[model samples]
Target: MMDVPSIKDFQWKTLAPLPSRRVYCSLVEAGGQVYAIGGCDDNGVPMDCFEVYSPEANQWNSLPPMPTARAGVAVATLGKRIMVIGGVGANQTPLKIVEMYNIDEGKWKKRNSLREASMGISVTAKDYRIYAAGGMGGDLRPHNYMQHYDMLKDIWVSLATMPTPRYAATSFLRGTKIYVLGGRQSKYAVNAFEVFDIETRSWTKFPNIPSKRAFSSFVCAENNIFSLGGLRQGRLYRQPKFMKNVDVFDIEQGGWMKIERSFFLKKRRADFISGYLKGRIVVAGGLGNQPTVLESAEAFHPGKNKWESLPPMPTPRCACSNIVVKNCLLAVGGVNQGLSDAVEALCVSDS
Candidate 1:
C-alpha cells in the first residue's frame, strides 16, 4: 500500500449543518447521498427527525421522520432502503422496534422487531441479509443474541449466539465471515475477539485485544485490524486513563503485531472517528485528557511507521455521528457545550 500524503493533501469543508441539533444519530451513505437518522435533541429526549444530505448541492433536506423516536439506533443500508433497528426510546427505555425507510418510496415501513428490547446493538448487512449482534437489553444486561433479518421472509431468524455478551461492539464483514471484537458489558469494556462463518453457522474465538479499553475504535485496513485509542480503567488510577496505544491484528499471521510506541496516536483520545483512508490509518476528534473536546487529527503511514498531524477539525466536538462517504469523512451532530448541528467533512484530494 502507498504511504498517505502530507497534511497538504487533506482539506476540511464545512457543509450545511443539520436542520436541528442532534447527538447519537446514525449516518449512512446510500446511492451517493448521506442520511442522518434519529437521535436525541438538546433536552436529551429521543427524536424521530430524519434528514438527508446531497453532496452535489451541499445541502440537507428533510425526510419522513421515523415512527418511533429513538437514539443510538443501529443502522445499515440495503439497496436504496435504510434499516433502522433497536435503540433507546421514550423515558430512556430500550426499544425492539425496527423500521425501514425507502428513498424511492419516500416513506417508512415497519419491520420485525427484535426478540428482546435493547440498545447499542451492532448491525452489519451484506448479500440481502442483515446481521445484528450484541446489545444492552431493557433489564440493563448485555445480550449475546445474534439475529439476521430475512428480506424474503420478512422475519428475524435467530442464529448462533455470540460467546461474549456485550453492547456497542465493532463488527466487520470480510467474505462470508463477520469479525466481532471489543464491546462493553454494562460500563466495563470487553476484550473478546470472535468471528462467525456464515455458511458453517458457527463462531471461532480469536486472540483477545492486548489492551482493555472503553470507547476504543476498531477499523479494518487491508489485512490488519487496527484497535485505536481509548480510555484505560483500573483501581490503580484515580480515574479512567486516556490511551494512545495502537494494536494491530494481522489476519494472515493470525496474531497481534508488535507495534512500537512511535506508531501510536500523538494524542490520547477516546470515542473518536477512525478509518482507513487512502492507505493511511486516520483518527480525529474525541474526548482526550484535555479540559475540553479534541479537534486534533492524525494519520499513520504504515510504510514510514510514523504518525503525521493533519488539519484540526474546524468545529472541535465529541460524540459526533460520523460516516465516510466516497473519499470524505463526515462528522455530523455531536456535543460541543450543547448539542451541535455542525456538519463537517474531511476530504482527501486525489492528487
Candidate 2:
C-alpha cells in the first residue's frame, strides 16, 4: 500500500497581491496565463471586467469584460480556452449563460448555456469535459442538480443530482473522478461529501466531513484533498457566529481528519478560492463580518501540512476565484466594500 504522509513538514510563502477587489469571480489557467472573471464588490454590486496574469512578466493585464456581470460563478480551463459558467448578478438573479475566452486569440465567444441557472456552483475539468455540481438556482434558491459541459462539442447536458443541495462548496479533479466538499444549504451547513464518476454517469456519497461548513476552500494535492478554514456556527457578541477551522480528506482511504493549527487571520465566514501551484496550495481572499472582505493570502504545503503567511493583497475581497498560471497565482474580481473590477497576481518565487 502507498504510504500516507503526515501534514507537518509543509512549508509556504506569499507573493504579491492583485490590483482590484471582487467576490464570486471565476479563476482559471489557460495558455500559460491565469484569468480572473466577473464578481461582486463589497457593496454587493456585480462587475463585468476580467483580467489576466502572466507569470513570465509577473504582472496583470486587463482583458475584455464579461458580456454579463455576475458573481458566485464557476470557471474551468480546457487547453488554451477558459469557460465561465452560471452565477448571480447584482439583482440577486441566477444566470445560465456560458462564455468562453480564448487566450491565444485574445477573444471571447458565447457557448452552450446551462440547463438550470446556478450560483456558487462547484466546477472542475477532467478529460476535457467540465462538470458543474450542486449550487443555488431556480428562483435564486439552492438545488441538488448537476450539469456537464462538453467543450469539444460546445454542449451542456444534465447529469445525476447531488444527494443534498448546497452552495459555496469546492470541487477538485483527480484523475477521471470529481470530488465535492462541504457547503451550506438553505436551512443549515452540511458535512456531506460526494463524488461523481465521469465514466459511470452517476453520483455516490463519500464519507461525511468531520465538520460542517460553507464557503471554505478545497484542493487536491499528492492524491489527497484538503479542506481549508471556514465558518462554524457559534454565538457572537450576543449573536450567532462562524468558527474557523481546517480539515482534510484522504480520498484514497475515504476518511476525514482535522488539522489542529492556529490561523494567522481572524476567524470569519467567507468563501475560499484556491489553486495548486508549485506543490503548494495558494489561498487568496475571503469575507469576514463587518469588513466583509479580506486582503491577506496564505499557502499550505502538503509535504508539511502547515500554513504560512504571505503578502497581503492590495484589495481585500471575499467569494473570489483563483487559478495557477505557469508559476503564479492569479486572483480575479470579488466583493471588496462593493462590487469591484480589481485584479491581482502573486508569485511565490518572490517570497
TM per candidate comes to 0.98, 0.78
Which parts of model 2 are misplaced by more than 4 Å?
A: 1-21, 41-43, 234-239, 242-244, 258-320, 330-346
Tens-place lDDT digits, model 2, residues 92-119: 7888888888877889899988877777
Q: Which stretches of candidate 1 lie over 4 Å from their true place?
A: 1-3, 234-238
Query: Which residue pairs in candidate 1 collide?
Result: none
Error of model 2, residue 345, in angstroms: 5.1
C-alpha lDDT values of all predictions: 0.91, 0.69
The number of the candidate with the highest lDDT is 1
lDDT of residue 39 for candidate 2: 65
Q: Which digits, one per residue and each the tens of the lDDT, describe model 1 over residues 272-306?
A: 88877787778889999854699999988888787
lDDT, candidate 2, equals: 0.69
